[model samples]
Target: MTEYGYFLSCEEFTPAELVDQARRAQQAGFTRLAISDHFHPWNDAQGNSAFVWSVIGALSQAVDLPVTTLVTCPTMRLHPAVTAQAAATSSVLLEGRFALGVGTGEALNEHVHGDRWPSFEERGEMLEEAIGVMRELFTGQQTSHRGRHYTVDNARLYTAPEAPVPILVSGFGPKAAELAGRVGDGFVTMTPDADMVAAFRDGGGAGKKVVGGVKVCWSSNREKAVDVVHQLWPSELLPGELAQVLPTPAHFEQAGKLVTRDMVADAVTCGDEVEGHVDTVRAYARAGFDEVYVGQIGPDQEVFFDAYRELVLPALRR
Candidate 1:
């Protein structure tokens, strides 16, 4: 059976709101929670970016649902050692109900330190090394590493989880999928692409959990929902490496001006039709996802959760 999860958008809500959403998600029958980690909102229109680690700490106190970072970039913005400590603390706080999802990271968050952004190939190499370093530190022993991108001197995590934290790798293409297969405890992506899933399996990911996420806007007014997605998440529609390469929220907003409401309507499930939302989620399951996380794009979260609890989730489970 495919477990259904709820996505907590850190970019769009305050920390308190995110914790409240997690509680509501559990009440609404979501089996797990995936929270995004972003230093900045994709665009100013979305308008919020709380530190994800702090929010996760709050979540530990507020809810019992298992939580995963929808994706975090430990290679930059913060060192892998620091990320290891945060993940370890989170796992301890959650009583072993935490997973780490990592990726190559985007320039929007990474360029903040005034460092030159490396190419995708270089970024991938850095991510692989960072994962290795973090995993070593999670064993709760003194560790030292001298790698191509980072250095660690006598780092040890005192509060590491009793068991190793499961690490999921996010991928969007064949090369990334192969990397995820080779190193990840699980694989994560935003699309329902069977071929990508197959690539992961073929590259040694068989039996590993495959996780996917989708965004939907549920409103009585379809046009208004489309408008909300257009305003808040136009970055979703960017093609190729644009999302990774964009240096700032201002650039994203400038690029997003080209994304139309029609595009969002076509790509996102909008309005009050429960069947459409159900089918959208089912596609991920059919593509062999072990878990599918659905995020409501705007502020109508209560309506979205109520509808899912009362109508959509039951249909999907059947």
Candidate 2:
């Protein structure tokens, strides 16, 4: 069975807001929760970036639903050992209801220390090495690793998880999916692309979980919803490598200008149509996703939760 969950966008919501959303999501019948781990928001309009670990702690206390990092970068901005400790602590806090979702990461979040961002190929290599380091530490055993990308000396997670924390690797393309399959316990991606899922399974993810997420807006006024998405999430429509390589929010803002309202209307599911929202979310299940998370864009979260609780979710389940 495919589980329906909610996505908590750390870039767009404050810590309190995120915690509140998690509670509300649970009340509204969401089975699980996923949250983004970003050091910076994609643009100023989004206007928030809270440390995801802290929010995770709050979420553990606020809701019973399991939480996963929609994706976090362990190769840079933070060491894998540190990330492992955090993940282990989070799992302990959630009583083993946590999964660590990782990725090579975007320069927007990873370039903060002034290190030149490595190419995707190099980043992939680093991520694989980092995952090895993390898995070793997750066992509560002392680990020392001297890898090309990172060095950890006799580091151990004393507050280790009671059970192994599943590490889900994120990817947007086939090569990344293959890498996720080769090394990850599961695979993560945003789109519900069947071909991408097939590539992942063929790359050794045959029995592993496939998780994904989507964003939609439920507004009484469709045009207003489109405007909100256009203003707050135009970066979603940016072309290929632009999202991965952009160095700062300013660069993203500059590039986001190319995305128009019409494009957002055409590409994003906006407005109060229940079927539209249900169809968008169900696509992930159709693509073989074991778990699908849906995020409601903009400030109209109450209506989204209400509608999903009363209409959309029931329709999808039907």
Candidate 3:
């Protein structure tokens, strides 16, 4: 069964708003939750980046739904050991319903430490080593690791999870997908691409979960929704490795200027048309995703929840 989830955008919402969304998501029948981890918003218009670990603590109190970091970079900004501690604590708080979604990382969030952003290959190497270290720490036993990128000396997680925190690796291409298959408990990708899912499975992820997320706008006025998305989230339309390489929100804004409203209208599912919303989400399920998270892209969250609760979700569930 494919579980439907709500994605809490740390970059676009305040911590309080995210908690409320999680609560509403649970009430509306979303069985899981995914939250972004970012040091900065993609652009000022998106406008918010609360420390994700703090919000996760609040979420453990606000909702019973399982929470996954839609993705966090454990290799940079914070060491793998520290991220393991945070994930373990979250698991304890969420009563073992937490999963850690990790990735090679975007330079936008990971470059703030004054370290030169590494090549993607090096980042991949760093991530693989980081995962090994974090998994060792998750055992709640004393751990010491010395790898090419990180070193942990006789460290242990005192508050580790009773069960392993499933690590879902995020990737956009085949190489990263293959790495996820080898090292991750699951695979995370934003798009509904069966070929990519196949690549992961072929590489060793056959029985593991495949997770994905999408953003949509639900409104009576379709054009208005497009405008809202264009103004706030044009950053999503950037092609290629731009999302991974951009160093800051300013650079993102500069690039986002190329994303027009028409492009957003064509690319994103918008309006209150129930079928559009249902098809958008169902695409993930058809693509072999075991879980799919949907995020609403504006201020009118109440209506989005109401629509999904009474209409869209029911259709998708059927």
Candidate 4:
């Protein structure tokens, strides 16, 4: 059996606008909401990265949608103790409706603080340590940690929720996935790729709740939707080695040329049409995703929501 729900992808809305979108998504029958938590947009060309925690706080009051950060970097840039406090407070504010999705760190986002991006092995270690710190702080007692990447002294969360926030670890590879299985109460990941799901289960996440999401261009006009998504998210077609070994965004941009509208459609269900979006979202179901979120890339979200509700959701509920 599969449980499917609607989630907002969130690139096209401002921090303030997110509250309204969350409200609308809930009204339209989406059981959950996922927001992209990014320190910076992949490039300056893609604008609108705001303080997401603040947005989450606002959404708590304005909408009933259960929330997650899709994934946050708790190891570097932000101290794990502080991240714990934020999650705890947010969880309380949402009436225990929030979950924390975490990742090691992304260079484009975490490297802005002049911290060296650690090797994958070191990052995996840092992630595990950070999870430990978060759990300690959530206990509502003083927490101290001295680790290779993070250190906190007598830090504690006073405004924690009655229940510790559920930790949903997100990962792309085996090591991180295994860590998530050991630490997370639930698992979160992007893409419908089954191998990634198997790796998470093998890593000890068996029977843990798994949530997944995908990106798409929402438009009634298929060609326009295709053009827009490809123009911005060309990273989809990157060859395996090129994505793994690339040193900078420039190299990424070069390999991104391999992306095309057809490839984007095949990998993700895209278009302004209602049928197209439903087909893409359902594909995640076929791949064993427990929850699949669909994001509308670029700004024009109101139209996307309306079309998705009228055309896509009705078909999906059946």
Candidate 5:
């Protein structure tokens, strides 16, 4: 049987509401929880981007489900040394039930400090070195790194995990997956592409766990849900260079005129029907994911969870 779970998109909920949602998810039979780490929401319609680490702290006390960052990048907004400590403390707070899912972040999240957003090459370099810094701190060693992207001076992680907190690297490209396989404890990607899994393993990430996440929109009023996600998340469709020139949600919304509800529905599951969503997730399990997480991007978390707990999870668990 597949172990079904929930993924809380932090962009959609307030800090306290997020904690409550996780707790409710636990009560509803979710075995694990993955929270998204975003510094900013692509649109105001998306509404709310709380610091994920703080949300994790509350979830630790409020729920029993294991937690992982769907992804956080220590390479940019945060120094790896500090991220190491944060990860360690989070593990402690969760009583050793936390994993750190990391990635080379997008400019939308990392460019907030008015810092020069390095090219992908520089970001990869930073990620490569940052993992080393995290590994050193995880070992409970007093360490320093003089790398091209990072310089740490006599750093130590006081709160190390009782058990190792696995580092799962999120990859969108071959080089990133290769790096994850080389440096990470596990590999994470959104697509259920086994060739990508094999690539990660081939890159020397032997025996690393593979995890995937997918989103579904479930509601009796499917059109409402579709409109919400489309209105808020049309940024998903912005083409290559166009996304760069578009600065805000309003820009994206204006550009979103090019996108229709069908486009959103084509990419995302749209409807209250539960079995189809189950099939959607089972596809990941069939693709060889050790674990798969499903997210509802519709409005009304309470109704979504009720229907999911009563309707969807049973089908997936079987």
Candidate 6:
């Protein structure tokens, strides 16, 4: 059976709001939670980006549901060693209910430290090495490593979880998917593409969990919801590698101007029809995703959860 989850948008909400949402998600029958990690929101209009680790810690206390980073970048802004320590501590804090979802990262977040953005190939290699380093550190034993992109000398995680934390790698293309399959304990992506899932399995992700996420806007007023997404998350509709390469929120804002309300309406599930929400999630399940996380694009979260609890979720389960 596929697990259903809520996607927590750290970029758009405060930590307190996120914790509250987590509680509500659990109450609304979302079995898990996925939070995005970012140094900056995709566009300034979204206007918030909390430190994800701190939010995860609070989540450990606020809800019993398992939590995963929708995709954190261990290769850039922070060294792999620091990310490993943080992930290990999070697992311990969540009492083993944490999974680390990681990706090669975007310049919007990774370029903040004045480090030159590497090419995609270089980023992938760096990610593979970082994953290796993190896996070693999660063993709770002193670890040392010298790799192509990073080096760790006699580092250890003092607060490692009793069991190793599962690492879910995010991929957007075939190469990245293969990399995820080759090195990740599981796989994550935003689309419900069965061919992508098959590629992951064929590349060695067979038997691993396949996780996907979708963004929707649930409102009685469909046009208002479309407007909200158009204002807050137009970056979602940006084409190609723009999301991965855009260096700043301003750049995203500039590019996002091209995304119209019509595109968003066509792409995202908006408005109050329970059937639309159920069908959106069911697409992921039908594509063989083991887990699907749904996020309401704007502030209509309460309405979304209530609708899911009263109508959408039960239909999907049935």
- The candidate scoring highest on lDDT is 3
TM-score of every candidate: 0.99, 0.99, 0.99, 0.90, 0.93, 0.99
**Model 1: pairs clashing at backbone N, Cα or C within 3 Å:** none
Model 6 residue 67 CA deviation (Å) reads 0.3
Q: Model 2 off-target regions past 4 Å?
A: none
**How many clashing residue pairs are found in candidate 2?**
0
Q: How accurate is candidate 5 locally (lDDT)?
A: 0.81
**Mind giving the per-residue lDDT tens digits that candidate 3 earns over 1-318?**
899999999999999999999999999989999999999999999999999999999999988999999899999899999999999999999999999999999999999999899988999999999999998999999998887889899998898899989999999999999999999999999999999999999999989999999999999999999999999999889999999999999999999999988999999999999999999999999999999999999999999999999999999988
lDDT of 6 by residue, 209-308 (tens): 9999999999999999999999999998898999999899999999998998899989999999888988999999999999999998888788888999
* Candidate 3: regions farther than 4 A off: none
What's the residue-level lDDT of 212 in candidate 4? Answer: 84
Backbone clashes for every candidate come to 0, 0, 0, 3, 0, 0
- C-alpha lDDT of residue 130 in model 6: 93
Model 1 lDDT per residue over 215-304, tens place: 999999999999999999999999999999999999999999888888888888999998899999999999999999999999999999
Give candidate 4's error at residue 131 in angstroms: 0.2
Query: Which consecutive 10 residues in model 3 have the weakest lDDT in total?
Result: 143-152
Kindly report which residue stretches of model 5 are placed more than 4 angstroms away from their true locations once superposed: 239-255
Clashing pairs in 2: none
Please report, in order, the local distance difference test score of every candidate based on alpha carbons: 0.94, 0.94, 0.95, 0.74, 0.81, 0.93
Q: How many residue pairs in model 4 have overlapping backbones?
A: 3
